[model samples]
Target: MADQPPIPFHRGHFLFGSTFSLLRDSLGLLRQLQQQYGDQRVVRIKVGRRMITVLLKPEETKYVLQENNRNYGRGRSYKILREFLGDGLLTTDGDYWRRQRRLAQPAFHRQKLALLADTMIDEAVSWTSQLQRLDKTQPVDMSAALMEATLRIVTKTLFGSGLGDQTTRLSQALNDLNHIISQTVLNPLRLPNWVPTPANKSYINASGLVTDLITGIIRERRQSTGKHDDLLDMLLRATDEETGEGMTDAQLLSELVTLFTAGHETTAASMSWTLYLMATHPDVQARARAEALRTLGTRTRFSADDLRAMPYLTQIVNESLRLYPPAWAMSRLSLGPDQLGAYHLNADEGVLISPYLLHHDPASWPNPDQFDPNRFAPDRSADRHSYAFLPFGGGPRLCIGNQFALMEMVALLGQLLVTFELQPITSEPMLPRPLITLRSKQPIRLYLRDWPV
Candidate 1:
């Protein structure tokens, strides 16, 4: 460890290092650092005594996330996530995570997800109906609406459509908890979850509300004789193939919380960003809508196959994810000393990989900043590096709900475009807010006008 060569680093404040700039504008500082150290595979930034090493190229990213993935583990941020999420797939590592993932994996199978398609399209159509009734002159908060819609879709698909009024309650409680988690993770001085601070107390209340609602539903489902065939039912009946033991109620709670929170949050952000881009780019909007209309014709309901058929609409979603990936920046802690690209990484040092950076690399993606859906068109995408576009991340820990999120986004966007003409309320572009997921700093407001029937 003592004999290793020093890695190149970004210079920051004399005392605090990159802490101030990192907290103020993380993405901007990262981009700046990458440019300052051009062609360097790995660049380090010191935040006080801690050094964060960011992989700069697609090859390095592929190495860490895929080729040599076993040497990396979930970082400290995931430890903070476990405070609220418990030891679920997103938070756990090694054997435990593998076991839980195995138990829950069947629920996300294409056959199972196909059964949930109608529920997703139904919720999206219902949402569009709500938009249709609203005054055309008023600007709608598309961000909040998409969040609510995705929440409902996840809720119904997870626990079934019986959650009539609990949907809003769960949505509010989850939002509060997500906000607290994001703040806690980002704030270096944040108090422990056990602390009696107001923020901590508020977090506890929201967590309790979510727990009560989910547990009550679980208990009811357990006592019922009928089957709903939802994710909850699959989880309830799932057992370990090795031990033949099933998840305990407590284990179920953790997985449920993980699924509920992770399921909708990122997808909603992606949809919101897509809408923002569509509103700003009328040409893209027209083309997408035209494709949707031509594909669906007069039908409002869509099947998974129908969604798969709309390649251009899928491109728009892919490009949106490329621009504003929900899990924008991810971290992994090195398990041991290793060579990554040109740099040697020490055990326990933090390793950062940003899809945001990779997606915007001028070398990999020409006009990287521009919104070009055709970049994902099959012919153009053939030669792109495998890890260059990691919207759902890569390797074994890739998001379990990736396909489900795609189907929902494409279906919802298709339904929306065919029904309404989205008009941006303001010409100013919405800036990305780096929360748990990448979201708009301001509410993405749009005025919806009924399209010709």
Candidate 2:
């Protein structure tokens, strides 16, 4: 029942709180407390005018994200993201989020996913085929390679046929955007766009590039005589429930940016980490490869139904996500006074939810650091708190494209691992850089052996 402020002695003035260090080493600070303060309800970290409360337990995390979700709002990280992402669901709250969520929800429906499956398999084949062209002695920088594959998957899913290399252009633009954002997220004392810092200039340039690419696609679609069977068409034709009108050009651009960014970035990171882990662990790799090879031998294509049948493949993915979820941490703002377990939170206080910390909690996960896919076995998983594992988060604000990301990974990883052996050329363990997404701090190099390395 000890509901007090977080251990508040960082190297900062009392009134100013721990501003710089909070930005520079956020997760480091949180994980430091995770082991020593087991089951502690809330620990407060002061940031500027706000007392940021960090939640470590599943039950408390569940209450903020789900049961009392109404009393919380999207907080800091998202607010900073708004500068680049605009008013997409990730940044907006209240009625607009509901409307946009409803309008875009159908794009990721199970039926819609089936439509995208053949294309996904086809793209995977083409991508891996090119890798075969590379000399085996030449190690691949998987971080970049995965981003290219994932960006194409997202674009094809949304735009369908007849768009040539637009996905590549968009990918480069987003890559530049990611670098600019990394600096912004890491350095809390941001210079405004007018101040003309190098990062600010890069962001403006990247933002313009994204806007131009999306607007061009919209213009081309409008000029065409036929309706395409893809997300862009669906979005173009969607009508608001009350207004009976489609989205404005600005709204369309915002949603396009949101979906395009969200759909690919995290999935690519997850795939990269999963591949790195498998490459480093022979037994884990063999087991996953066995399931995939059995499921899809001598076949280049994987149907949507194939994903459902691969239990071990699914478990491997679940475990990789446990270790390196791309959306590693989430933030929320208190809408009003509230109590979570024994801790009392004030109105407008920022709350930090670190799934990266929760997934590693030894109290819930025995031998937490070890990689074991069997942790996701139905019986074992059922006994754990529902919120104990939140790679895609939970409740009403759960990632809308969770299924899309899962389906993409299952199809791509299951098929690719069967075709190629990912031999890690990077050191024994990879280091993570937590930013807009969880990414490898350095290029994760892996040799793409034809198999049985």
| All candidates: CA RMSD (Å) | 1.6, 2.5
- In candidate 2, list every pair of residues with a backbone clash: 6-44
Worst 10 residues of 2 by lDDT: 3-12
Q: What local lDDT does model 2 show for residue 149? A: 84
Task: Kindly give the stretch of ten consecutive residues in candidate 1 with the minimal lDDT sum.
Answer: 1-10
lDDT of 1 by residue, 343-391 (tens): 6888999988898988888888989889999999889999999999999
In model 1, the Cα lDDT at residue 371 comes to 96
lDDT (Cα atoms) of all candidates against the true structure = 0.86, 0.81
The per-prediction tally of clashing pairs is 0, 1
